[model samples]
Target: MSDKTESVSTLENAMQLMIQTFHKYSGDEGDKYTLSRAELKVMLTTELGNYLGNAQDKNAVDKVMADLDANGDGEVDFTEFIILVGALTVACNDFFLEYNEKGEKKK
Candidate 1:
């Protein structure tokens, strides 16, 4: 690993990457601190890829936009963006736990 990555903890690296990714997309258009629908679409397709279901689908993106826009502001601010990442992390953790348990039972 590079010296910078070798010094950073995994969680810290993850946090920094998340922050960087958000800013990377958020600055594409509209408010620099928030994500417009188009920016969100690009972020999802680029960053999330298949980890998120049908991120390329217009309807799917619309649903995510609606759900994440908790403040009815029609744009996803950093906090709202973090909610998406947090929920996905939780879901992935749960899936990993279930898969690990099943694997142990099979052994």
Candidate 2:
């Protein structure tokens, strides 16, 4: 492992992963810093299939693009992409917490 990677914390690694993943998709076409509709669709299906089912459906992808385009710019920038990831993480954390609490029978 590189010295830099070896010394990085888990949260830092996660942050880096997010940045890399966004750039990976964002560079596929057009602007290198934002995700066009096609790029967003590919990223969603490839990277988030488990979290977001039926990504192949155009309507689903369209809905996601609409929701994430906070600036109405028709493309998802890194900031918007990060917001999506953060929201999904929060949702997953909430789901897991609820699941654990239910299993523990804590009313």
Candidate 3:
């Protein structure tokens, strides 16, 4: 999972990227397996800067943490992180579909 990218399928590569990205932030300040609020904030702002333009806003980070901390543990686990990413992916897909449709209409 570390460096053997040649053998991985596209979906597997995506999964590995998710795992790597989560760990990259999870171990920053608190539990190595979960993301504290601060760690989550850093991860969102740093890793998703383009998608989440104002992720640096304190309120936005707080809202994301509150929504993702499903266990009420004040930290986000891998599953929770995946949920956020999956939702965002779906949203992105929908946006692109709509944009494509609009472009076709204008053509």
Candidate 4:
């Protein structure tokens, strides 16, 4: 298989693993495996620790939550959570790939 294909497969596997793990912990109620935009934002912010500081502006997070919550529900379901997680995974993977490429170039 081509390098690009291999990369895609790897990402797919990683996403599946994440979803499985989430489901294992979250249970099957109301799509608990998926995370809403608000949930994801909160997670990321918490992970960032002191980097984000005390950013009170919830505009971005609100917008994402609103967009992802397609059913007009107050909370996110499993499908929406999966979509958001996929987007985040792609972004993070791309960022790391770029960083790795740059490092390789520097060597």
Highest-scoring model, lDDT: 2
Clashes of each: 0, 0, 0, 1
What's each prediction's TM-score?
0.91, 0.93, 0.92, 0.52
> In what order do the candidates fall by lDDT, top score first?
2, 3, 1, 4
lDDT of 3 by residue, 41-89 (tens): 9999998999989998999999999999888999999999999999999
* Residues forming the 10-long window of minimal summed lDDT in candidate 2: 1-10
TM-score of 2: 0.93
Off by over 4 Å in 2: none
Location of the lowest summed lDDT over 10 successive residues in candidate 1: 1-10
- Report, for every candidate in turn, its global Cα lDDT versus the true structure: 0.93, 0.94, 0.94, 0.63
lDDT of 2 by residue, 1-107 (tens): 55655587899989999999999999989999999999999999999999999999999999999999999989999989989999999999999999999989965
RMSD of each: 2.3, 1.9, 2.2, 7.9
For model 4, residues 1-73, the per-residue Cα lDDT tens digits are: 4566545578688777766655553443444655544455664465433543442358756766687788886
Candidate 4: the clashing residue pairs are 35-81
Model 3 residue 20 distance off true place after TM-score fit, in angstroms: 0.3
Point to the candidate with the largest TM-score: 2
TM-score of 3: 0.92
